[model samples]
Target: MRIGVFLVAAQFPGMDSGDVLRATVETIVAAERAGFDDAWIAEHHFMSYGVCPSATMLAGVALGRTERIRVGTAVSVLSNRHPVALAEEAAILHHTSGGRFVLGVGRGGPWLDLEVFGTGLERYERGFAESLDLLCAALTRPSVKAEGEFFRFREVPMSPEPPGLRPVVACTSAATASLAAERGLPMLLGLHIGDEEKAEMIGHYARACPKDVPAPGHVAAAVAQVADTTEQAVATLKARMPEWLRPGLAGYVPVDGRPRPATDVDAYVDRLCRIHPVGSPDHCAERLRRTVERTGLRHLILFVEGAGDPAATLENVARLGAEVLPLVRDL
Candidate 1:
């Protein structure tokens, strides 16, 4: 299986913007040294929740630093940018990186992203579909033509022929996953759902994909921490979980039905560990293997720097690279 790191440019309580950016690049370098196949960058804006506003720019920085490992955006929010500009930027990066650049696309989330970009949440999905259509046409065809509900464009041709780029979609729902299948694109699944939900989503994608066409290998990202013993891993989670589960963070809402308060550290840690791949090397390897078998995921993107605690996060990356990765290398 192909394995990689998903760089989450998370800003901890005391970290400045520069600190977050530096650490993100450092994580990419470390992942390359650790023998990761790729490093995917995420885009976030107008919040310390995630400081990186341009994942493509960060992907360029990572490409400049690492020679072997592939780099791509975990997702560049399509709803937030003009498709032409994004296609041009990504195509340039792809050319510059010798075709190692991947253009992962997604709809900007319903929260701060849309509000700050002056995009309406009501039309977000429609806009996303329209954007995806335009983006695909722009990246593949010599010229672009769109008369969709959300975007209207003339026959504007992209300069310098587009490369052979296979884009992936960051899918959070079965509908979007099916959309990926329809477009013959791969899907990137996050670790926010239960195992049953994951199974169902994967099954849906597999079924929706055409029988004559080869199914694009799907990727799944997980929050991970490994140590000598399960107890040690749990201890690290206990220490870092509170900060990671801070209130108002996206994707982390209810602490069992109510909004999570800052004090709900233990409960939050338990919840996170229950759904993520966290344990000793052997333990993690077995779980990951089962995940691959069950979900038919060919790539696993490990989020090693879960809490943004530099010391612990780096150690987790190192240990995962040294211990866990070798054990599960064949998976």
Candidate 2:
């Protein structure tokens, strides 16, 4: 199994953006030193949920800092940027980083980001498949032309072509999973869903995937924290995560001028704690093993910043590598 850390650059209350960014980089470096296989960055905008606006930009920083560990985006919102521009960035990173850059793209929500980026609600709702197709073409082919509903352009030659650059798709539903499978791309499953839901999505992908294409290795995101005991790990997150999640979850504004549903912060956190690996090394290992057995996912990107403290988060990463990883690495 491949183990990785998911960096969100979560800006907790009383913490500045610089603090969050610096800690995020430090955590990535620490994760590399702790023998992690990859570091996945999250992109967020106009919200304290995650301060990093560009996952690719942060991925560049991480790739430059670490030589061995791979760097990738947990997801870059495809609706907010042009497919060609994103493809160029991915190609540059892939070449510069020795083919260690992984681009994970997602169809973002109907948030205010669409308005700010001048991509209307239609793009987020309907244009993602077109954008993804264009991106795949730009990455795989020497030159490409797009005459699609959302994008129309003459043939543009791809510079620094990334022939083997396989992008991962963030699949939150069956439609997205099928889309990814049809394209022969791996799925990056979210942390919110349980193992059964993930298994179902995997089933959907298996059914839709073409026979000629080799099966792709899917990635699963999970929240993790290592401590001396189960109670300590649970207490640490319960104390800090809610304060950070309360404002962050409530900050998203719908672009359609409709009221968004309220998220119960405590309840959400409770669910995460229950479903994820948050405990001692042995307990964490057991949880991860069960997840692998149930979902058949070998790639795991663990979210370790829920403690909302730089020192604690770093410790969590180190302990995960030192203690929990060995217990589950052979699985």
Top model by TM-score, which number?
2
**Candidates' C-alpha lDDT:** 0.77, 0.92
Native-to-model Cα distance after best TM-score fit, residue 123 in candidate 2, in Å: 1.0
Cα lDDT, model 1, residue 294: 77
Task: Choose the strongest candidate by lDDT.
Answer: 2
Residue range 231-257, candidate 2, lDDT tens digits: 999989999999999888876899998
Clashes of 1: 0
Candidate 1 on 1-331: residue-level lDDT in tens?
A: 8888887688767778888898888888888888888988888776665788999999999899988889988889887787778888888988888888988888756554565566656557577777787888778888887787777767877876766577789989888988888888888887666556777888898899888778788777887888887777777777765674563164433212444334465776676676667888887788788787777777888877665577667777788888878887787
Clashing pairs in 1: none
Q: What lDDT does candidate 1 reach at residue 119? A: 61
Cα misplacement distance, residue 326 of candidate 1 (Å): 1.2
What lDDT does model 1 reach?
0.77
Tell me the lDDT of model 1 at 189: 81
Q: Which ranges of candidate 2 are over 4 A from the true structure?
A: none
